[model samples]
Target: MRKISYNQYQFKVLLYDVPKKIFILLFLFIFTLILLYINLEKSEQIAKKHERLKVSESTLFIDNILDMKKDDIPKNSIFFLDTTRMKSPNKVRDLTLRQACSIESAAVTNENVKVFIVLVSPYKTLDQVKYTPAMEAILSYKNVHVNSMNLLQFSADALYDNFVANGNLLKSRFVKQHTSDFVRMLILIKYGGTYIDTDMIVRKKLKDLPSNFICRDHGFLNAAIIRLQNNLGKKVGKLFIDDLIRNFNGSEWGWNGPLMLTRVLTDLCQTSNVNEMINCNGFHVLNEDICYPINGLEWNQLFNEQHASKVLQSVEHSYFVHFWNKLSQHEKIACNSSAAYAQLARKFCPKTFSLCHEYF
Candidate 1:
């Protein structure tokens, strides 16, 4: 190479350094953009994300407790619920109303009995759960406790395999219904409490009924409203767990729910007929009028204005009115309306009716 002047050599070095300088600047710029994007993403979703809240008598967490033994539950516990599966706006509204109605009914009928509503995952605040209105309404009551229990807690450790297997099948299909079906039994078994579906309008204090009992609906044993006693309740609950692990039929709807209850009770009692509440082994079976006065197929009767008077009469005599969320979640029970559901909502769950008027 030809020898160059000092000025030219200096210029050449500067040229090389200029690109390096530019590359460093460019890299920093891109990194800054990335960080900005990430923060923005989190900020935008914070509204929908779970927030940490205090744990109290009325608000608690069953988080990370894999082996929730039966004794872990309280003796005075008589109510349990689930609303972790529903996600849609309409469904959320229904849950809010359902929860409101449930809390109101419990407060009115059985102020002494505590009602616990379980959430799917952990969250700090009800606002982060996407059903803030309903959650707040439920929490507003003195007897209602809103809590979060990890799905794994229900069947973690050695039972992990069975829990994940059955849960996976349910998650892909009926996330809300089947999961509710499976977990409700576990909750009842663990706590020996009454499991009431959110869709139903509670008609009376749950403790007024037998301590250990299940109801019949449409000539089939229904798990919608069930009260599990201590020893026998634990036995039936164990059977439910075993059936779910060994013979869980995710393909057939209600296999883990009503149908499973019918099969287990029949075998446990060694009885052929489970259509009516039979005083089997230790638990009693109640007639359909106890929890499901209206069959699932004719759930519309509650929302039909013409059936308003009749539905009112029937629900008055029933323990709870099952609205069948699958069929009636989208149906509006407008406030100050003539619909049977509206009438019931106003009379039983006034806050829920107000929310329906405000949100729906």
Candidate 2:
């Protein structure tokens, strides 16, 4: 046999063995690309499905709003607006126990008055939205009606009807606060009914209050509770709405809210004194204690076990109890605690109180 050189032997091995190794490597690379392509395709499909589901939910919500009839909502209704924008069923936009307490107390005290909880979300329907135990408790009342309304649609006419369309409200640093201030005024102008803030707990029947009135809070008229009625051919609600729109300023926080009410009442009554405003025909200004028994400076007293009795006793003669939620929202009131808020919730909004497992 002829002996081969080392170089020729290596050349033969490279030609024979390298082809098999390269073929295997090429096959693996192609397989990995195929697997990656399949996974990417599945991910795209799932994303499309999720998008479609969201569209379906939003469409249903819009349909529900369109189905609502004007007659379904009573003229003497009490309106509470929920301005949260809900995104999904898993992310339910239900009321907190404290907020539900406000509604429950109102429904319990004003059994004869229709209570309308207007949801200002355009993407979630009442039927599709999940209800918390607190929300269900309030909804058990026959007078309570949970309805959906598109904020943009409802504000369309109001925005175009006045000089407020200048986008001052949209430019505010506190957009939600300003929007709420404007919406409450628009609701009063359009419906002529009572508008109560979600932070208030009703202590007495609001239906029996003056036809058109607002409560005073620390020298300024508060819009927290407003009962406006068109009577004696005087469109007092409209006048306020017009004035608010004409003098719209989004720079200051409460300028469009409590402060605006003060200015408007002064203009309407042609006097700066609260007593004179109360004497104004077809309009009244209630005393501060009637609604805000505890000032914002002492709002924590409502949640103090030691001061519970004192706080309760002070508000005994009051028609409403404004807890200054803005100042006390982060302060938790323990369930069944001796805090004044707990006691009041237990007595006035028992259902909401009972549903709370821990701190409210």
By lDDT, the best candidate is: 2
lDDT of 2 by residue, 158-189 (tens): 55433434556656777667767777777766
RMSD of 1: 12.1
Q: Tell me which residue pairs clash in candidate 1.
A: 51-124, 51-125, 52-124, 53-124, 277-285
Model 1: lowest-lDDT 10 consecutive positions: 122-131
In candidate 1, clashing pairs total 5
lDDT for each of the candidates?
Answer: 0.66, 0.74
Model 1, global lDDT = 0.66
In terms of TM-score, which candidate is strongest? Answer: 2
Native-referenced Cα lDDT, model 2: 0.74
RMSD of 2: 14.4
TM-score each candidate. Answer: 0.72, 0.76
